[model samples]
Target: MNSNSDVTSRTVTALGPQLRRRKSIKHMVGEAESNSGQLRRTLGMWQLTMISVGATMGTGILVILGAAVPIAGPAIWISFVIAGVTALLSAVSYAEMAGMVPVSGSSYSYSYATMGEGIAWICGWCLVLEYAVSVAAVAVGAGEYVNQTLRTFNMELPVSLAGGPAEGGVVNLPALIVVVLATLLLVRGARESAIVNTVVVIIKAGILVFFSIVAFSAFNAGNFEPLLPMGAAGVTAAASSVFFSYIGFDAASTAGEEAKNPKRDLPRAIMLSMLIVTITYVLVAVSAIGAREWTWFVGTEAALVQIVGELTGQPIFVLIFALASVLAIASVVLTVLYGQTRILMSMSRDGLVPAVFGKVSKRTGTPVAGTLITGIVVAITAGFIPLGALADATSIGTLFAFALVGVSVMYLRKRQPQAPRTFRVPLYPITPILGIFACLFLMSQLGWHTWVVFLIWMLVGIVIYLGYGRRRSRLGQLSKQDYIASHVGENQ
Candidate 1:
């Protein structure tokens, strides 16, 4: 009996540190506000809402129909609803987490405070893939639309300079152009970036409204006749793919630290932005299909512009539509690129990544070094890689992260029942459970190649965490006494 108790004591001691390894919610929020890691809190609810709207509304709407229409035919509107609802459920969970945690790490921070370091690292890794590759994907779409605009003036770049290597061009110089425009805005500061994004968002939203009006005039109810042409399975599969269109609703959560009233505004921003994005997506998808045959959408570039152009037969309208798309897509690159840097900054603060990524400039109050590095990297990606291979990869990564966020919400609600939250997920467990199920089902619909790529990326993240992050972790280095003190009321 003595020997068994001693053996059990030793085992417990060995596992103690691992058990206490999760970063306390207090410590994580404090670290965000610390002088060394602080970001300027200039954003109000409107700016935060715009960031989410700008990020979520642009990339997928501009390009996804061309790819998704063939898969689901006229029923693509249902796919949009499926994707939007999946995103809405997760967005609600993110809102609850944002109010309770209120940090720049978004889902990563939520995972850390609720789950543990291992889970948090996995979430962060998916975020890196989600944001960076998405920037590239959005930029590629912007480049093509920019090309459309140039053609109206008969000044389009030669094919060698205009297209990605996949399209037989040496480099997609126009993609690089849009990335640079966004990079310049971001490096300046979040306030200015938000201002410009708000302006561009309004312009693009107007252009979309105009497109809807014109499309309705040419509405062909016949186009929607075979609404379930491909059946329910097809709608679900296309929902899995088109879910990429709803990826940016959590952009507001990433701005938690930068919000003037993070606990109050973050939740509001997330919910409001999600509402706007869902309505816009459904409206646009319905309008587009009503105006044209689903068959014509396949292989068409700038699907919306084509619809408006064919409907109106006006060169000036095509020019206007193309310009708005360029702005819209650039805003997405800007907001997502902003979210990407902030995630790394939070991770670096926890000593998971390089310190350079965590550094905030005194003048601009943004992560200057991180912004520049991210810009250069994403620019190169947009310049070279074809957009087709990039799209599914982003959706898979995002879905994985979102499912974990839903899990995090459930974990926290049970673990810290007393924690204050400005916003609570409606219907509690059911919403989150549905969110998790929705994400998993959508993820199941993804192509096997996307799964392979995602698995490889996760493998790389594991290697990095084991080899470097585990040793350098700020949380791991904390003394047990200090850790307990830091935890304070989190466990209660």
Candidate 2:
């Protein structure tokens, strides 16, 4: 057994270096030379952290909890813990990978360098699920808050203008409008976008804290009766649903190419943002459940506002928080739309997607065309689809991307063991293995319809990869077979 194990280790040691031939580590000091790169690297550790915070801390906290509470009952906070623990497992793995493969594509770039181009393309397509679809889902939540705030003035946004077709409306104009607003901000450039996001992140994080404190004041011990009303399966199912809330925690990794210090900052921001989100989410969920009966959460679009209004009976307070939710949700749209375009840009650079998606305007140093196009598509989807369906789809995509990132990390650990990493997963293979299992377990808890949608999306991705990406992949000359043939005997 020892002799056989020794031979296996020797073969792996010989093959590892040959397998890892791809892009150089992308940590330019401060910023890339103006002539060297397209995207500007003006984002600091604070800005990068806020991007993750702003993007993930939105609609999930403000709106989705209302939907999740009924499923998990008063123990909804436990669902958050279930999901956050799963996310933490993946977040640490992401931190390790981001530190090593600090680039714009996030999981997609990491996969390409570790798993090969085909898997990388699939990862990027899944990212469209995570970033693009979540943008639309979160925008729908923002539209609800918009209508709720307008109602305070005795003016209501008509369903045709503010609600999705699934809700018996023609088009969700507020949803479209919100996406347009975020898109415009993204077109202004990354630095300006980051600054705006930082401000909103601080404001919204504060708003959540304010909500938790106020909720505790109204807390009733009776609300805690029968914590798991539907049983443990229900909490797991609700966790699957609320996993959508953690969707954009990887937004920091997507900005790896634009960070002032990608290696150090990317890992720090990824870990920090997820920690903040998990702690806040659990606190907020527990506080909310303590304040309101779980069954009353159903069909609530403005849950946080409703909770505050019921507790204080003050129209002004409700109005302020509702307006704050609008600003808060808009930040999610801004940061997520930014992440979506950057992922497309990275894929474009790799020839998996079109060059137009990768184009950066010299004036703005941003992907203007790509951002506009992404916003338009997301807007149209947001206008037609309901939040519940979109949220589930986004969760599946997120879990899929996260699972692959876990795989990517484990793969790199074996394939490039000596790679320079500013951070490492705390438990190495065990952490990544658990991350993958946790993501898959949660995904299984989702409804079958979500799986069907994911399959259809994968079919489309496969066809595109076969017709386009497989032919034009920029990693063409460095084909695995060609490299092996050239180096095998010589190295031996």
Candidate 3:
């Protein structure tokens, strides 16, 4: 027993002061204030909701219908509903945690407060894949739409520059350009990026609404006859795919540090965003199915535009759809790039990742180095990888991160009941439990390859933690007095 104690004491001593900071609610709030004061708190509830909606609404809405409908038939509409509810539950859990913790790192920061240094590192690594790959995938999708729009005027890039080698071309130059531009915007600072994002959001949402209305004119009731042709399993499979459309709801949580009243706004923004996106998704899916047969979607480039063009019997509709897609996807790349940098900043502060990732530009108050590195990685992926594979990998990482957040909420509630929360999950254990199970179900539906990639990525995170994070962590430095004082002040 004595020998075991000695070994444990040595192990504890080795974790470093930063890793053992024992962040209390007060310190968490203080940290958020310090990092985010440079950002203007100009967003109200509605703008916040719109930001979430803009981030969540993207290529998935335009692309997934074709991919999902073949699996679930007309019943894919129901799958959208299922996926939306599951996402909403998780969003609610995130909202509560964001409100209570009010920190910028999303799951990474929350996990640190509740699960300790090691788990937080893993969560942060998962987010790297989620945000970076998402930006790349969205950029690739945007590139396709841009090409489609250009084709309206009989203008097209050389085949080599338009697609990857796997697609019988060489490089996706347009996609690379999009990622690089988004990175530059992010490095400039939050205010400008948010404004650009807001404009993109409005354009995208407007186009989606326009598509819904016009597509309805071509609606044929006959398309509804074969609902659920693929059965319940098919609907579930489609739900997993449709779940990708909801990816950006957590973007609101990442702004926990910047929100003027995080406790009041964060949860509201999350749920409201989920609600708006769900409605838009259901409308778009129903309209698309009513406009065309399901199988026509397979292997079709610019599927949504094609659907609208075919339904309306006018090529102009395709041009409009393509333009809308470009704007939406651009917003996704921008928001995701911002999220990646912010999470890295949080990890750097905790000393779990390189300190350079956390370095904020004194003038801009943005993570310049981190954003540049992320942009470069995204550009490489966009220029080389296939969109389908990148999208699957992103979904797997995001689902894992979401499930972890749900679990963290439950863990914190039970472990720190006295901790003040500005907002609480409406259904308590049921909401979080269902959220975790839902995320797990979606994750399992991803291809076996995605799981393998995720596992390998996680192993890399573990190695990094053991090699560096554990030794440099802020948590390790906390004395008993510091821990008690931090918690006590928050409680008061």
lDDT by residue for model 2 (1-492), tens: 355653443344222332243433332222223323778889999999999999899888787799899888988999999999999999998899888877788888877766656677778889998888888878887667887788889888887887777888888887788899889999998999999999988888888998999999988889989888889988999999888889889999988778888889999999999989999999999899888889889877678888888888888988888888999988999999999998898888767788899888989989899998998899888888765654577788889889998997887777667767899998777889999999999989989988888888889988987777655554543444544553342211
lDDT of 3 by residue, 31-130 (tens): 7677665544555665566667767899888877777788898888899999998888888888888888877789888777776666677778888888
The deviation in Å at residue 9 for candidate 3 is 11
Candidate 3 wrongly placed segments (more than 4 Å): 1-22, 36-42, 386-390, 477-492
Predicted model with the maximum lDDT: 1
**For candidate 3, what is the TM-score?**
0.92
Backbone clash pairs for candidate 2 read none
Tell me how many clashing residue pairs each candidate has: 0, 0, 15
Residue 418 Cα positional deviation in candidate 2, in Å, after optimal superposition = 1.8
Q: Of the pair 2 and 3, which is ahead by lDDT?
A: 2
Which candidate leads the pack in TM-score? 1
Q: Please, what is the TM-score per model?
A: 0.95, 0.91, 0.92
| Model 2 misplaced stretches (Cα beyond 4 Å) | 1-36, 385-391, 477-492
Model 1 clash number: 0
lDDT of 3 at 294: 70
Could you arrange the candidates by TM-score from highest to lowest?
1, 3, 2
Q: How high a TM-score does candidate 1 get?
A: 0.95
- Candidate 3 has its poorest 10 consecutive residues by lDDT at 1-10
